[model samples]
Target: MYDTILVPTDGSTVAEHAVDHAIDLAETYDATVHALYVVDTSAVDIGLGTEQVDRIRQGKFGDMPELEQRARDATGAVATKAADCGLDVTEAVVGGQPHGQIADYADDHDVDLIVMGSAGRSGVRRALLGSVAERTLRTTRRPVLVVDAETGTGSD
Candidate 1:
């Protein structure tokens, strides 16, 4: 019953698991996979793209280019994997609130399902209760499938 699936990647190992699950779902349903990588502006220091030190010292402000490149790399990897699975894939790099961006993207693209990791790159203690995943579940109108990186158990 799924025509479009979304998978958000932050270049984390947990996210990699999510990618695998998403790809499998796409293959089964013949759905198009959208790989989105968001550059978390909130995590950046001083509201700038640069690190905390650069923001503190006011020395530079060009870290955004590097961050964008990193985001592209992350998305590209997802796209590559999805393509290798013989699934239709669309990939993009965005900067904004992670949960908001993901939810908005789902709405804008009419995504049927979202597959995500239970934990983040920093390794959260709770699965499906992590900040982004929880917020996404609260915000999105579509169904969310959260896969535990350690256990590989998925709950929707």
Candidate 2:
């Protein structure tokens, strides 16, 4: 049913958990998996967040060295996992608000579904910061398969 599946990763253990779900879906539908790493610009106003956003806005993803490494590490992990499962995977790194960026990526790329972790590293901060997966679900029209890393389930 799906031709392209999007999996957003933050290099967290929770995010890695969702990678398994995405790979499974991709294999089922014979779809390609797109691994996206969004550096949340809203989280930090200082170094990488702000700087990377400006570069991304200008369509320059190669200017920031350290941030690029981080993005590579995050997306690369997902790509490697999907590859091991014999799935075709693509990787992308961008800077923006996580939820919005994720939805936009899905729309812009014509993604058929999004499989993401319910909670990431923003554990304690979740109450105050809110959940990225929740926000993406609220904003996107595409089918979202949220993998609950804490419980190892895909329901919620």
Candidate 3:
């Protein structure tokens, strides 16, 4: 029933765990996977891309080198994994609040499902820091499959 799937990755080990699920689903349904990386401009301490840090310091920016690397690394990892499964994949990078960006991407891209980790590298800090998966689940209309990194249970 799914034609398109969205997997939001932060290049974390936890997020990587979810990539398998997204790929498996794509393989099962003959769906295309979209890997998205959102550079959280809210937590920028330094600019990665060559540009005015002061200018980006005031607003959302995804062109920073550090964030760009994270995006490339995250999306690249997804692409590799999906490729191994013989699944079609696309990658994108954007800047915004994590949950909002994910939700917006799902809506704008006609995503059939969202596959993501239950938590990122933040770990237990999630209780205090909140979760991108949780937020995206709350904000998006698409069905979300949250893979548990520790247990690796999401499929079926």
For lDDT, the strongest prediction is 2
Off by over 4 Å in 2: 47-52, 56-63, 120-127
Ranking by TM-score: 2, 3, 1
- The digit string of per-residue lDDT tens for model 3 on 34-131 reads 99987676676453453543444333343556656767888999999898888889998776688998999899999999999874446578768888
Each candidate structure's count of clashing pairs: 0, 0, 4
Candidate 1: residue 44 Cα off by (Å): 1.8
Each candidate structure's TM-score, on Cα atoms with residue i matched to residue i, is: 0.82, 0.86, 0.82
Candidate 2 lDDT, tens digit per residue, 1-156? 999999999888888888888898898998999999887766644665656568864436665677678888989998888898888999998777889999999999999999999765465688687788989989999999889889768964
Candidate 3 lowest-lDDT run of ten: 53-62
Give the alpha-carbon lDDT of every model: 0.81, 0.84, 0.81
Q: What residue pairs are clashing in model 2?
A: none
Better of 1 and 2 by lDDT: 2
Worst 10 residues of 2 by lDDT: 56-65
Candidate 3 residues lying further than 4 Å off, grouped into runs, are 45-63, 120-127
lDDT of 1 by residue, 22-132 (tens): 999999999999998866656665534345434323322254567667777888899998899898999876656789989998999999999998663355555434678
- What would you estimate as the lDDT of candidate 3? 0.81
